[model samples]
Structures are given as C-alpha cells and as structure tokens.
Target chain A: MTDNQRLYWRATRRLTVGLLLVWFAVSFGAGILFREALDAASIGGAPLGFWMAQQGSIYVFVLLIVIYCTAMTRLERKFGIDQKGSDQ
Target chain B: MSGPLWSWVFVGLTFALYIGIAVWSRAGSTRDFYVAGHDVPPVLNGMATAADWMSAASFLSMAGLIAFLGYGGSVYLMGWTGGYVLLALLLAPYLREFGKFTVPDFVGDRYDSRAARIIAVICALFVSFTYIAGQMKGVGVAFSAFLDVPQNWGIAIGMAIVLVYAVLGGMKGITYTQVAQYVVLIFAYTVPAIFISLAITGQLVPQIGFTSESVLPRLDRLLVELGFTEYTQTTKAKIDVFCITAALMFGTAGLPHVIIRFFTVENAQAARRSAGWALAFIAVLYTTAPAVGAFARINFIDQVNETAIDDLPAWFETWESTGYIDLDDKNGDGVVQYRAGADNEVVPNRDIFVLANPQIAGLPAWVVGLVVAGGMAAALSTAAGLLMVISSAVSHDLMRMTFRPDMTDKQELRWARISAAGAVVAAGLLGIFADNLGFVAQVVAFAFGLAAASLFPVIVLGIFWGRFNKQGAIAAMVTGLVTTFSYIVWFKFVDPDPAGWWLGISPEGIGFAFMWLALAVGVLTAVATPAPPDHIRQLVEDIRIPGAN
Candidate 1:
C-alpha cells in the first residue's frame, strides 16, 4: 500500500479506538457499573456518576469528535489527499 | 404560568422565524431538493442530522424510559449512540462515496435493476409513514402539555407548520431548521435537569447526581426498601433486554430519515466527518437521558410519597385531571411507587417526566416556556424532516423515476411539494383518528422495525455484494416487510402472550431477527441463480471515487 493509504488507515484506526474508549468509559463505566462509585467524584457540585451520565459525557463526546475531525483533516493534508469538490 | 401572553407572542415569533428560514433556504433545483446540492459543511450536516435524529422519541420519551428502566434502560444510551460508530466506520464513507440522489437510486444502480429501486421506495414509504405518525402525535402531546390546547387542535396546527417549511424548502430548508431545533432541544433538555439535580442531590449535573449518594440518605434506602431495585441495578430479564437494545441499535442505523442525512455532504470524506459530528451532537442529549430519567424518578417519588392524597401537590391533580397521569394509591397510602414489569400496579405515563420537569424542579415560568418551545422544536423538527423524506421519495423516486421520466425538474419539484403537503395531511388525520396512539416510543419502534426488516438488507447487499439482482431485492424486501409487520401485529393484538415460542423470543426481537434472516436468504437465492453483469461493478466503482460529481 502507498504511504498515504497507510497513514490514512493508521490515523482513522487510532481515532476510532480513542473514541470507543471514551464511549465505553462514559456509557458503560460511568453509566451502568461504576455509577455509584463515580458518584463519589463531583463536577460543578454534582456527583461524578450523575454528571457523567447527563452532561459531562455528552460534552466529552462532542469534544472528542471535534478533535477527530481536526486531526483527520490534518492527516488528509499530510497524505496529499485532496477532498475538496471540483464541482463548485 | 398564565401571565405569559408574552410567551405566546414569543411562540408566534418562533413560528414566523421557522417559516422565514424555510423560505430563505428553499431549494432551487432538483439537486438541492434531493441533497442540498451536496455543499453542506460537515459540522452543519452533523448538526442537521442530529436535529433530524433526536426526535420526540429522543427528546421526550428517552429520559423517562431510562429513569424507569434504570440500568437495563442504558441500552438506549449505548445502542443509539454506539450505532454511529458503526455508521462512521463501516457504512457512512462507503455509502457517501457511492453518491446517488436517493437511497433507492443506490440500491437500483448497485443491484443493476429498477425493480430494486421500486422495492426500496415502498420500504422507505412504510418506514417514513410509521415514524411520521408518531412525530405528529408527539407535537400534539407537547402542545397540550405546555400550551394548554386540546391535542387534536395541537396536532392540526403542528401538521400545518411542518407542511409549510418542508414543502417550501425541501432538504435545504429542513437542514437549517433542524440545526436551530437541535440547539433548542439540547438546551431545553439539560437546563431543567441541571436544576433538579442541584435540588435533589446538591449537584449541578444530573448525570453525576443520579450516581452520587443521595442528598437525602433515607430516600435512597427508601427506594430499595420499597421493593424497588437499587437506583443503579439492572432488574430486567437479560434476553428481553438484549433484544430491545439490539433492535434499537440496528433500527437507528437502518432508519431512512437518519440515513438520508449523509447525502447532504459534498463527498464521502465529509459524510464520514458529518456522521462523527452528528453522533457527538446526539451524544450530548443521549448521555444526559439516563441521568434525567433517574433524577426525575427519584425526585418525583420524593415529592409525592408520604404526602396526603388530597395534598399531593397541585400539578398532580392537574395532570390527573388531564388523564396524562393517574394515581390510584393502591395500598391506600398517599405515596406512589413505580416498579418494572407489566404487573407493576403503579403506572405513570413516561411522557410526563420531561413535560413535568419544570414543575417538579420548581423552575420559573420563563424556563417552563423554554421547555415548551424545546419540545415543539423536537416534535416539529423531526416531523418536517420526515415529511421531506416521504414527499421526495414519492415525487422523485416513485413518480419521476417510474411514472414520469420525461417530467422537467420544475414539474418534479412541484409534485414533491404537493407530496409533502399530502403526507402532512395524512399524518394529521392519522393522529386525529388514532387518538389512543399513546406513546411516541412504541410507534417509532414499529417504524424502526419496519426499516430494519425491509430496507437495511437491500441497502447493505446492493452496496457490497455485486451479484444481487432485482428479483433478490424484491424478494428480500417483501419478506422483510411481511415478517416484521406480522410479528408486530401478532404481538400487539393477536396474542400478546408470546409464550408458545416462535424461537422462544418475544415479538419485538423477532422482527429484527427475521430481518437479518430475510436479507441472508434473499442474497443466497440471488447468488445461487446467476452472476450480475459488468455494469454492476462499474456502478460500485463510480460511487467509490471521492470526486464522483
């Protein structure tokens, strides 16, 4: 495979893994199993579990994807991938 | 709450704004009508997609489901958002790369058959209609709760509003309006939750507050003492739980309204980015759902229980009067406790939690007004998006593709507008006639099941497997629809027992399982018969290149 192809694959794979980890941490870890345990931690005067389930996790998800988009765009440029439409 | 003549004025202004936005962003051509001319920014597409997706079900029903179901209900939190991962990684890029005007267009070209497109159109209609009926009802419920109007009138007004915007702007108008709706809904959903969390648990965030030790220690223990599972435990049966989660996950991915969002982006790469962005946006609402659900359940119980029946707060009396909430106080104790399973004697409508949040949290009138607007945003936004999908499929996919190939773009656009209006009228009538179609969640679930069964298989096979033919696509789609619809009917009305065992599973799960089976069988039969020609592979190659346009 070309270096560009390899770079694209690696960047996507890493981001996917990272996103999944955060997803698991918030939904499964904080939401289900360790909910009470995390409640021990507090955010904005709220317990960690409640915060994670309601607001914090969602905030994290949005930030995570924004990061992914930025990084992926950088990857595209590095690999000489031109994604812009010529139609316009 | 009554002093809000100004609130009503604000609502009028919001409505006018929506109409203005629709007119301003109206699609100019067939390409714009179909895919917003594929110039939408990834983030904007993401936001629009999120608004389109987080319907009355997500905005209104989900938090209550999580609150009642507890840990088992986390399935929605996981299942719906998790599917985005699947979409981004497995589906979005590929589908976007293979750019087509409609989902049926993809299926037809990929399978090298017009018959496939026809079958796809039917499935999309079934899916869109089943889902749209519930959205219209949701708008009525929201209006009735906050605006103090009769539900039938609320539904009619809601239908008219959706028709105006959707028919006028098509995809472009719908896209921009959805972004506004997403902002309104997310804010409306979280603000009350935060206040309630602080009140009950001394926490600002509802998500964390549910998990934290209760601010009132006795309340937590009391929940466990009253034959209720721990606030954090999973009490539901594993099999049923798994099935519900799987169906919701697959259903989200399969839904035509949601899938069509990808087409708005310029190319496959943008589509991938948009999917990620949409999920991220959706996650904000989804993750909070469980927290809101749990916190509402706890707070609601805390307020009602141990209080005298006559003294059980003014809102309860009002809610009871409206038939939205009922309190029997079965043990003759003034307090009400809600438990899982069908047998649980105490029942409260899940829809009320979000609607009642302002009163429950003791927020100001303005906040309550905001909630009203938010609920409208959720209901109307989804309704408008679905109307566009249903209408476009009718005019473009079925009419133009099949009946009137010679029709100009201008003529087609007119038909599309007419179709949008007709769909809204139909939905309004259905909402009026099926007055007892109570929960939006159940109705939306039926739509999801229909989509999963019928369209998902055809879409998947047509894209990946080159050998799939028209005959196979038709057979698969029909089989899927029949199996799913039959399962739903048999369970909903015919038996409701589900004990005699068609694979020892309940009816809801059976729909999804049958869908997968039908798809497999359809593909196998197609493969066994004959090889597809070279054009099929060529179509695949065309969709693969990033600069297809």
Candidate 2:
C-alpha cells in the first residue's frame, strides 16, 4: 500500500472508533445503564434519563452520522481519494 | 363522505400513483433491475431507503408499542436508528466500493468460497422472508379495519400490487415508488400527530409536546391514580433492554434490503451521505412516536376508565367487536376499571392504539383514510424491497453464480422476475397463516435477531479484519443461525415458557447473546486458520479506500 493509502486508512479507523464510542456512551450508557441515576435530573419537564432513552439519543445519533459524513469527505479529499464523479 | 367511502378513495388513488410510477421506471436490463443502473442521487436514494426501512412495524405499530412499553420502548427507538451509524461508518462505503449487485456477491468474492456465498444467501432469504410476512400482515390489518375487507383478501390484494411493480420494474421501479411512498407515509403520520399534539399540549411539534408540562406530568398523575406505574418509569429489567437494543442495532445494519439500498447510489461518498439522509427522514417519524403514544394513551384512559361497560364510547364498542379490545365484567360489576394486572377488566391490544388514535381523537374521516393509506404504503413499499432481495438471491446468487454460470443477462432478468412473483405468493400465504405464527411486531423482532446473529458479524469482520477467512465466516454464520433460530422456535413455539431461558433472557433478546458468540467464534477461527491469499487482502484494501471503485 502507498503511504497516502496507509495514512488515510489510519485516519478513517481513528475517526470511526472515536465516533462509535460516543454512540455507545449515549445509547447504552445514558439511555439504558445509568438511566435511573440520570432520571433524578429533568429535561424539558421530563426526566433526563427518560428523554435520553426515548428522544435525546436519537437526536445525537443523527448528529453523529452527519459528523461522520463531513469528516469522511474531508479525509477523502486530503488523501486525494475523493470521487471526482460524486454528486457531493 | 362515509369513512369506508373515503378510505376506498384514498386507497384507490395511492394504488394508481404507485402503478404509474412503476410503469415509468420499469427495468430495462439486469443492472437496472438490481441497482437502478447505479445512478440514483444521494438524497433521493436516501428517501427511498427511509421508506424501505420504515416498514409497517414503524408506521402502524411502533408508537403503539411505545404507548404500552413506555420507557421499555427505548429499545425500538435507539436500536432501529442507531444502526444507521454502524452502516454509515462501518458498512456502507466499503460495501459500495465492493460494487456488487447483491450482498452475497461480496461475501462470495471476499471469502473466495462458494460455500460461504450460499450460506449468506440462506441468511438473507431467511431474514427477508420473515420480515416480509409481517409487512403482508400489516397490509391485511389496515385493509380489514378501514376498507372492511377480510384479512386474507387484503393479503392477496397487497400481493397483487407488489407483483405488478416488483416483477416489472424491479429495483428501478421500487426505488422511485418508494420515494413517493416516503412522502405519503411521512405526511400521513405527522399531520394527525401535529393535530393531536396541538389539542393536548398546544405545541406544534409532537417531540416537544411529549415533554410539555401539559402532557407527561398529568399522564403520570392519572396513571398513579389508576394503580398503574408512572408512564415514563423504567419498568423492564435494564439488562433485557440492553440486549434487545444491541441486537436491533446490529440487525438493522445487517438487513439485506437496507444494505442493498446503498448499492443503488452513484459512489461511496454518496453512499455515506445517503445513510445520513435515510436516518434524517426516519427520525421525523421516530421522534414523533413517543408523543403520539402519550396522546393515544391519555385519550384511551380518559374514555374507558370508570365508564360502565355498556356505556363505553363508540370506538371502544367498535374495537370490542373486532376482538382486539375485550371487556370482562369481572365480579359482576358493570363498571370497568383499567389497570396493569390480570385482575383488570379491560384487555387493550397494544397494536390498536396507533390505528384507532385518529378516530379516538375525533379527527376528520379523511385523516383516518389517509392514515390507512399510509399504513398500506409502508407495508407495500417494504414488501417490494424484500421481494426484490429474495428474487436476486435466487436468480443471481443461487442460479447464476452457483448452478448455471453460462446463463445470459436476459435469461437472468427473466428468472429474477419469475422468482420475485413466486416470493410474493409465498409471503402472501405466510401472511394468511400469520395469526398461527404470532404478533407482527414480535415476528419482526425475530427477523432482526437472526440478521444480527448471523450476517452482521461476517460482514463487519470481512471488511475490517483482513485475517477473517472463508472457514471462519462459514463457522460463525452457521453457529449463529442455528443457535438463534432453535432458541426462538423452542421458546416461542414448542414450550412457550420452559423451565428457564439462558440467563432468563427472552427469545426476542437472546439473539444479542448469540451475536457475541458469533463474533468470538469468527475471531478465534481466524486466529487458528492461515491468513487469506494476497489477492483477497488486496481486495480488502481496495474496498477500504473511498474512490477505489
């Protein structure tokens, strides 16, 4: 593999691993594991944990995907691997 | 107009529009049939993916599930949507770069083994067929309720409609039709939600309305008064919720129909962006779900509790005749007291809440008609996608790749169409027998569990871990498939309870445990076996790079 390809691969792996950890923290951590502890607090007139389980985690998931897309696009450009024919 | 009359009108118009889209987008060749000639725009492909992903379960039954499960329902919400993150970051771009017409094609090439390909085909067919049966039943339920047709006839009619588009237009036709269906289903879902939210909490957005001071606190108070647990409390064991949620997330990413949607887009980058758009479109309905559940529950409680059985509201009386809602005059008392125990006099089917919400709130007849159409749209769109997957698996993977390598493209397309028609007929029969099987939502969960345990591990490991070989993939898939399937059948059918389950986890959540088992077997086998050949390792690197296609 070329130096550029190896660098791009490492960068992509780092980004995916970091983002996945965040996904786990919000969904499994805040949403399920620590839910009762978080429930003692409130958000928008509902318990914080309840909101996270049902609503807040979904919003965060959407945000995470958007971030992944943007960061990947930048990484592709940096490595000169961006598709020239892409609609983006 | 009368309710049935309005329902007929809405249903007829939507069917006509779907058929028209199918006619215009009919497939011309194998490429067009399988992946829409790989020219679909990212955002448009995303909308189609959303429609294909949000099946009848999402449109007709999910909010009802949430209404009944309360905080326990987070499994559906987080599990279904969080898988998109897995798809976008882990699966989509790499799979798109592999440039295949179907998922099994990639498996066959990556593992350099026809046996691995065949196993993948079986897994895809198993998951798609199980999921499609639930969609057919969803169609049946909507038709039986709104159009006053028998459930069997409803399944046949849904089969016929799917046959027309799915056989003729294939993926090309299904894609555009799904885009149109997405618009209809989302509009039909959100409009009634907006009205109910405004009436209940004076908030325009249902997500905000759910947390509004007017909604949750009052519902919690009334629930406590009636001897039920507070609506938002975590009543389910935390471990069970975690297992179910994890299974669903991985299963969603592994689903063949959803993964195939990425194959239709122009490039890997478009695939990534498409995954984002799909989640955004899905979130519109998902986020609104809890609010809809809250509104429906509040309305239902106010209408039934303390009311004399004979003096119940017209909706309750109507639903009672359908056997979905049963009222027992326990202790010979005329008054009905609804609560969460076996001693309660009312048995409310959770599936009824979403379908009956508009009527319970006294919405206009047209809104009810539109919601029915939306439910059918959700069912039919997903059924078409699943049928397409089944057909391609038969014609492409089983026939062309395995049995008849000399077949021409024209012959392959014909086989694809024929297989699609056969699948629709088979799924229709399954729908007819669905009641003997189980509930639509629970049946769909089993499909997810199977996909999670079997396909998810192989696909992720094949891409990320180049050391994963044909032996490891085959061993992991068979072990996962057999373990999960037998456990579900034994508990759900044979014994129905047994002495105890593995660690007391129910069949719906046990697939998550098997998913970990599959991963462990896959990694251990890879470490034991020799590494794959250099060409296969090169293929992995090629897929990892974005523009390699």
- In terms of TM-score, which candidate is strongest? 2
- Please give me the total number of clashing residue pairs in predicted model 1: 12
Docking class of 1: incorrect
Q: Which ten residues in a row have the lowest lDDT in candidate 2 chain B?
A: B436-445
- Those runs of model 1 whose alpha carbons end farther than 4 Å from true positions after fitting are A1-81, A85-88, B1-7, B215-220, B329-346, B436-441, B467-471, B501-504
Alpha-carbon RMSD, each predicted model: 4.1, 1.7
Error of 2 at B391 (Å): 0.3
In the range A1-88, model 2's lDDT, one tens digit per residue, is 7899999999999999999999999999999999889989887768998899899999999999999999988998888986754322
Please give, for residues B149-252, the per-residue lDDT of candidate 2 as tens digits.
99899999999999999998999999999999999999999999999999888899999899898778888898888778888876667778898899889999
Instruction: Please tell me what DockQ candidate 2 reaches.
Output: 0.61
lDDT of 2 at B340: 74
Q: What would the TM-score be for candidate 2 when compared with the true structure?
A: 0.97
* Residue B366, model 2: Cα distance from true site in angstroms: 0.5
10 residues in a row with least lDDT, candidate 1 chain B: B337-346
